[model samples]
Target: MTRVVGKRAARRAELFDQLVGLFLDEGFAHLTLDDVAARLRCSKSTLYTLAESKDDLVRAATVHFFRRAADEVEEALARVDSGAGDRVTAYLEAVGDQLAPASARFMEDLARMPGARGVYEQNTAIAAERVRTLIAEGVGAGEFRSVSAEFVADVVASTMVRIQQRDVARATGFDDAQAYRELAALVTRGIAR
Candidate 1:
């Protein structure tokens, strides 16, 4: 029974990942449950096993996406054998890379969906806090100049929100991924010792 349950859980996770990939490659707004089922080559019942409704499914998928991205970002940071400042740059660059696969349509769809947008906003806030922690560590280790980590994190958070809202893209003609890369460079250079 335990083996059966484990296999079931594994299949669910795999299906969920496939759903997320489809949503990432193509926005979810235009896709109905039937469309999703058709794309995934699974029945609507299988999707229902993941979430109760289409909106819930989208929200769950968004959460999953961020969770995976966070893991990858940390993994990238772990591979960096440099000082705190370099780790900070690596963290942000990994974030950019994680977001690189998100198409404009997916972003637009996220903006239109309050549930998914909220998830994105929450993750952005979390990322800002992570940045704050990294900055504080750098400052404590004397790898970065003395600066108010909280203030810098607030700025980064605000920019992240703007990036999510497409304001940065509109103003600079840079996509979210590009904006993140630019942000990484700017912040690293600004805080470096």
Candidate 2:
């Protein structure tokens, strides 16, 4: 019984990993459960048993990506070797690192499916709130000057959104890391006494 349970768990993990890899590599819109099953050399029934639907698989994949990203951001923020400004910088850099590839493919996928826009927007807002909270903490520590944390957060969020926009991504040479660094510097200066 224990061996059977462990085998099932391992199979589910393998399926989930394959689904995420396919979603990231091929773009979610381009793949189907059949494609996934085919790629995994598994039966459609097996895939369906693991995920109720393709939408479920996509949602799971997205959640997995964001959860990993959130963990990285949290870890970056908790680093004692860095000051508030440096921590903030590390946080932004970490975000850019995740967003660079993901956003490009996501934007392309979302362009064709309007329904997914809401999910993307909600996630963006959450990221902004997190950044805003960080700014607020910095201000409380006297690392940042007196300024509206909400407004600063909005600016950072909006800038990131713009960066994700298709034309801006292309115009900026896809160097979101550079853009994020510059934006962080600008924000840092704005709130610095």
Candidate 3:
């Protein structure tokens, strides 16, 4: 019985990862369960069994993305061997790297769909708080200079979002890596002591 439950849980996690990858590759607004099922070569009913609804899928996908992002940030922070300023730069660069893709389309879709606005806003608030907590920890450890952790976190999050938006706009016009590099440099300068 335990083996069966574990197998089921593993399968569910696999489906969730597949769905998240699809959402990131193709904008969520343009993606459908049928598409996910087709990609998985499974039935839509199977996806519904895994997720309660489309909204549930969106929430799960959002959580998955943020969780992965937080892990990467943690790893980047761990790698920083320099002062608070350098650590701040590492963190900002890590964040920009995570958000450089799909950031613009995600925001545009959220704005266009009134129904999703609340969920998006709630998710953003959660992300901001997570960043704030991380910044507070960095400050406590002297890995970040003295500053209002909450305010700096908010600015960092907002800056990342805006940079991603601009990246999407210039997707065809400019290289994403170049844009992210420039933005990271600016953010690092602003946050550095």
Report lDDT per candidate.
0.92, 0.72, 0.64
Where does candidate 2 stray beyond 4 Å?
A: 1-7, 101-103, 114-116, 164-167, 175-179
The segments of candidate 3 whose C-alpha lies over 4 angstroms from its true place after superposition are 100-107, 110-151, 161-183, 191-193
How many Å off is the CA of 76 in candidate 3? 2.0
Model 2 Cα lDDT, one tens digit per residue, 24-126: 6667787777787899899999878866877766666666666666787678667746566776777787777765555456656754554444455666688
User: lDDT of candidate 1?
Assistant: 0.92
As a TM-score, model 2 comes out at 0.81
Candidate with the larger TM-score of 1 and 3: 1
Give me the displacement of residue 51 in model 3, in angstroms.
Answer: 1.6
Comparing 1 and 3 by lDDT, which wins? 1
Cα-based lDDT at residue 7, candidate 3: 97
What is the per-residue lDDT of model 3 for residues 101-127, given as tens digits with 9 covering 90 to 100?
654467465545544555555545665
Tens digit per residue, CA lDDT, model 1, 12-57: 8898799889998999999999999999999999899999999999
lDDT of 3: 0.64
